[model samples]
Target: MFVSRKSIWGHTGKVMALALTLALNGACGDDDDDEGGGDNKPGDSVKVTGKVTYDFVPAVYSTATRAGTLAFSQVTKKPVRGAVIQVRQGNTILSNATTDDQGNYEITYKVPSSGSLTIVALAKTTTPSIQVEDNTDGDAVWGVGTSLPSNAKTRDMHAGHGWTGGAYNAEQRFAAPFAILDSMYTAARAFMNVRPVQFPELKVNWSPNNVPGAGEKDDGNIGTSHFSPSDNEIYILGKDGVDTDEFDSHVIVHEWGHYFESNLSRSDSPGGPHGAGDVLDPRLSFGEGYGNALAAIILPESMYVDTVWSQRTGALAAFGFDAETAPSPSDDPEPGVFSESSVMRILYDLYDSGSNESAYDNVSFGLGTFYDVLTGPQKATDALTTLGSFVNGLKAQSGVNTSAVHALLAHYRVGAVTSDFGDGDTSLRAIYTPVASVPYNTNVTLTGGVEANKRQQNQYFVFTGTGRTMNISVSNLSEDVDVEVYRRGTVVAAGYLSGTSPESVTFSSQANTQYVLVVTGYKEADGVYGASVSITSP
Candidate 1:
């Protein structure tokens, strides 16, 4: 009930009150000079925070990358400053920085050619501030690039001279639309019902100075700069940092596609990369093809822009691939660079072909569908299950215990090859016997018209460690055929006979090894069929 007045207290009383509040926030030290620590040593704990920015003009068609500074306040829920922040990409490391009292900061970092990257900031009172558990924020900071700008978090930005663009040209392009190379993950989570922690570190970075003829100051190691090795960080080669033409069409999408493929493969099988290929042969091609396809998928009505290169559609179009009527690139009489699918080229064909009419069914167009021959579900609803089917098939072929799939996934995944194939032992996927012996006088039928006895698919091989020479032949069949060698489902090799006239193949094999041969008919049937292999000790 007592009334309070606004009148000031005594000078001494007021001074005393001011000192108390200063000490509480550590804004002002005690009367003792020692309290300052000379402004060098760590001061009273201050809550630190920060926000990261990446910009690429999404509305435009050029390859200009720009960035902005996002202070802690902008982040809405800022992190505790005064602590260390680390960013990463896959297993690569990028940077470590500390936030100031205002809870804002920025640090330089390296960015990889292409792929999804993540950045992380950890706050802890102790020396080892960060550990396995990192920042939960996805759009925190990118050592390179990880997302595209949207109306929600994007702005027409200018960082410096020659860096004119918004947040959609470079890495920012993926930010708003798909979470920067996160299409598979989004689809996986919604459709597969799994929320496995797939990403670990973070990578963040960007550059706007890169233009066709305008030179840039920084071009990373091997003309390829990258940072954020940990799974938590991400990086983007600034538009000014690399050639927009090649980088955007060939490099960026290609590399990111690898990550998506790796992740999907991981979820599908216990084995990672190695298993993925064996289990999902089409997936590998499809995965790589998908990357190339993204350019078309995103633009839908545009072509790649490489200031200096030939302004033309992808190779798939020039070659005129026909999925329904023409033979696959595999069937090309004299295939050169046609062996591998240029994702860009393939995707362009997809767009030109239109959505309702997936040109994939035609072998002539080099357009094909993994789902059509996959014998499983499509990517939208059952990615995990669909991938598992691929893994199970590969595992069954590898002749290894299915339980060991996880261990294999870990093993090869750590190496250059990610052993995460859903398939078992890939050895059975195909066999390559350099040397073997069979009576060439009578051909083994590859057209599939003759039974095992009628064609003699099984043959004999005598091996010498030094590598032996051998040849094969098939009766009357005119078309060249492919054959896979196996050991209890382990693939020894998978290939076609380079020569056709005599219907024969020459090869060398490992010494003291017993090999089994399985013949596959050519894609098309030539009717007359017969074939056999022969191995001669050197």
Candidate 2:
């Protein structure tokens, strides 16, 4: 029961000597002494046990009203699962362990008689390889620690929210990083259930100074919580008086969904600012919609809540919506294939079991079905990944209720669910206009309200090559234009000259092979433009 450290050490000395004698007498191989035996035997160390937990503030949201607040009063302790634990005496690590699902860890280390020890729990895991770091602090890993010797052998470290009395203490926000890690773990595990995947190391950057404005990431002016495909990093907002996303599980998972798409599936979205009411490009609509739906599915909750707190007023405000329900036409405005709201509702309906208010949602294909298509056909489709491409892939699956899917699609006003490129919709132009004749020329219109990636900002064209050299050009006297040629989702050629008109590109083509041309304005120019394509014999 309560054994003295001195007595234990004495007993361990006897056992070590006996083991060393046995090894010297040919009882074990020479490698046995080097392999955690002899002087570094298990009997020479003391077993350390502990649990790592962090305080969690759950969001209080209403499914009916689609709004909620951070329930600070209902704060609870959640296990810091799959996180690294280290026992250190000063700067030297004596032992290391990983917390189990229940936050329990066991480590063996030779306890020194004089020096004090500390237990540090890091917000990191090696299996899936994820780490949360403080951007303001030289990108140091976030962690919490407790004096191990002071707490005796059964030491437990609990990261507090740092909320004291009516205000938050900056030094006490130790729970934020762990909370973010838990949300990522939930999302990653959900996807792993459907498909076995080896995730790359993901670094999540967070800081108390991180606010809503574009600036240097190291200084913490991160603009907003977003996943950067270029750097493959996630920046989270943690401005104390403005906004903090530590408790916004949906928001965290939503950003993680983007990471999932980039690594596991495919995303052709022209990254930009988009919202529910905006008329976005079909690619952006589908990408954003899938993110929202994936978060809801991973959370296994229809309501998506983002809570914000004001320190001065001590008030909490939140705004969200039920991903399971379709928004009103007035709220969504353009509810169709180009609307993110429509895409989110359609995707959620496809995966969810049933909804009491949704009359048209009579199908539940489950997460496995959704994952299969997202990772398989949708990733390889020649056309941009849009609602049309996703639905077309779903319909191809055996035993899928196509009629029920059609009803959901019709409810969203997305027209027909036939082809990857919107085929049967007359209201929308053909996704790729065809250049049937050589020396083909046409006038195209680009009209939008200064938004760079809206539906009306760009136009697409297709052509069949005849084993000859081809010249493509776009002319706009008053506006800067750009052109790009693609074959099977890969760019063959592009013209992106700045402050210039009549941009052109040339390339040799193979016979009977189809190529797509995308023409757009520089900085979203709004005017009529002329485009021409001609073929010459090699």
Candidate 3:
């Protein structure tokens, strides 16, 4: 049996061992480890065996897929290969084994004087050992299990233990999935209080060999983690001598938020790189800000930390920020509607219990309120969804405290929010254009771009329907633009094209219904455009 002499599971300078014994009804099928059979014999141990499997949660990620159909979550399972299993007695190691491609493992070792032996599986690699498929490929093991897919194995290990938190280690690598599971459970609990929902199994991909430029250009970037909607997979960073994200609970939960958003609700976010203080695109701001805030809400901790390590040393330890600072200072030179910092602060302040006396701590609606709006109208709003759209959905809910909600928003410099479209809102730095009104048969000309207002770049037009046919057309556009018609918060018809082209749409309308015409540039495309709306009222 090989002994473990290094610390793992994020604990620094500590030791851990697994115990196993054949005394419990010949605990292990094979009695080779405990040959003496209850007779006091030196160098006698026990054996253990089991199988490992990882959970996979399939949810939609592409905006097109999500918009075309209502996606539901479901769980799938896959066997985990090459995870390490070990047996120990008290503080001493006895035996170890490596799982096969089928995830089966059998280990035999010698106990160090014990009445009962316990066995555990270590998800890391220790050199000068056996039971591995490839020693040079970095195909080290990770914690695996046969438990319910929704539950994480790390939580099971920490059960009944008072863990005061630890540093980065191999054992901690197994804990990351559990940490994300904890966040999902918190969100599920909050939402189920009003309406029930199930979280599909999520496949977490990580390894000690994962590093910068190891895979595809966007695929393998060290210290970067993302949830790919196309494949319904979560890829985390694992750097051998540098940064690894397995122990970064906040980061793990943040990526989980994207999964939740894409599946449970609707996210029009143009996914891209963003930071806390950057003035991002409105859609990107709301999605990223929601993720950051949700991570803190799930942990309910005073601070959110992300650590980076290198060469057996912590390059950046516990580098994080306060979660309670309202109207938080940001790195962006100018803060406005597109500021994720402002959005996150506003959201946290709204959900906080108001136990403190700060002006930003007066509102206390909780996560239930937040979840309700996101799953309800906000998910179906007839506007380019943003923070304002979410706030409007909140106000539309019954039993919501309007005073507290508005007060929380106002505290963050988001002026009086009276509609879902967020029209006519003017910031201190720029004049935001009001939504154009396209009466039954009126033609309107408008100009919009990412550089026009810096924040409110997407141009919106509103019209009242009359249970007939409505035809909308856009022409004279200088750049690639798409026009979508939204009714009661869902896209009814869209004029999406591959290149620069005129856009047009025709759809049956309900009487007295309010329809929003969303004319937005594709990515960096932006320019002036003319639109005409004609209605054939019966």
Candidate 4:
């Protein structure tokens, strides 16, 4: 725990002062020994006060192109709130402080008369547990240090943008880490406003060398700005010539939303590459759409912008969109529950008070409504977290306007979702077939959509375990198949052999427990597959 010296002084300053006086008297033999020590007495303490600010580059969007550009001339100094401030003399830390809302902090500690001190502002916090580090440098925490005044004088620290005549200097890119931390701080504060939440530790990795390519992360090839659930860390792209996202608050908060879902809510998305105008898997659609909407809600504006640099002209450019409006039919031909754009529009409409042109969005339930559904029902729903499940959970809330929700769903080509399993939609009603008897066999057709993990690549089934060993298998003669058994939101057994016609798994089950089975075509190929379930007695 990072304890603030201000609190300690406020609570026990008298006792600490008495103890220090007694120790100083014992060490010096008598008070007369330090009489000629001038203003630097043995028990004398210096008060250090300062403010931390960072240069923020805002994105200016063009209405005609629907994109943005970095307005370097309009850079403003913003407060670096809730960051750790440390005063150290060589290798020993003298005192600690935390910046308040106005970016101001104060620390008082005994300072030696001869040694110089350095004050550092770290991009970290203990209450919400967020840290920013440069992955290229042994994962060292990013900070800026300056010499502290020897006397009780005021000092300040500013992180500049490192912008020069035509480009950014890599050596002076001190504002990148703090920019990412500020965005995450805004996101965490928004959630805490709705409800008191203790967020898990989240580390954000950013470096000037982090480029956009698939390779080793430590070597600065970070593929893209995304959240890795396997490591529970977020990697932001900071390669200057290719793409840089440290100043893009929406991009940072969007990835933070994925972290929120992984820890706070629930997500069953089999992570993949997805973008606008693509018909995605329902799980991916919901997850991505929720991320987009949550970022808009947390930030001050609804426009999402991501800045990039053009290699051809060496000019900065950006890709942006409005989360509050619906995309044109030409841009998004298939707007439905399987579309991320539709999901984002629907969710933003539900929370925003402004009138929407796309639908009859008269519902403004605020963040508290969405918070209740996400942390309560949506996290515990039996079905996968999708648009249908979210809508069902929203309608089940105490005083939600179901009529408006139905209207919004209808506008997106989705009817009233009756259950978490999507019973209202005919195409999804038969998704989860229940097996009542032993030796159950079913023939299912797997259709390859425009891409893998979209719509028809998998089939689901459910059954009740009899406290005995069971064999679950899937076989396809011409294509590879995989099978998995899950109980209570976790996979108990799985078989995913490559290039094999049949995949099987055997596991002992508990009595009177519900189990789910999923059979999929390897790589989401188009084929006819056979799935079977049978119990083996002891």
**Each candidate's lDDT (Cα)?**
0.30, 0.75, 0.53, 0.75
Evaluated at residue 344, the lDDT of candidate 3 is 72
**TM-score quality measure for candidate 4:** 0.87
Error of 4 at 1 (Å): 29
Top TM-score hit: 4
> What residue runs in model 4 are displaced by over 4 Å at the alpha carbon?
1-42, 311-314, 355-359, 523-538
Per-residue alpha-carbon lDDT of candidate 3 for residues 1-538, written as tens digits (9 for 90 to 100): 1112222333311213111111222322233432333443446444445554443322222222211111113333433344455554443445667656565667666534434444554443222121111111222223322111111111112211111233334432333343333344444444555656665544445655556444442334433667766655566666534655554556667787887777778777757667666556677788877877887787666345565553445333334554556322333344546788777777777777745647645666767778788888778876656887888888887777777777667666676577766742455212223333433455454455444223444555667776777777664445556676777546798887756666767888886777766665544545555555343334
lDDT of 4 by residue, 51-109 (tens): 87888998767546766888898999998899988777665668888999888988777
* RMSD values, in order shown: 20.0, 10.8, 13.8, 8.4
Following a full C-alpha superposition, what root-mean-square deviation does model 3 have from the true structure?
Answer: 13.8
For residue 499, give model 1's deviation from the true position in Å: 11
Steric collisions counted per model: 132, 1, 16, 0
Compute the lDDT of residue 513 as modeled in candidate 4. 82
Off by over 4 Å in 2: 1-43, 61-67, 112-115, 165-167, 309-315, 327-330, 355-357, 427-429, 437-439, 464-471, 506-514, 522-538
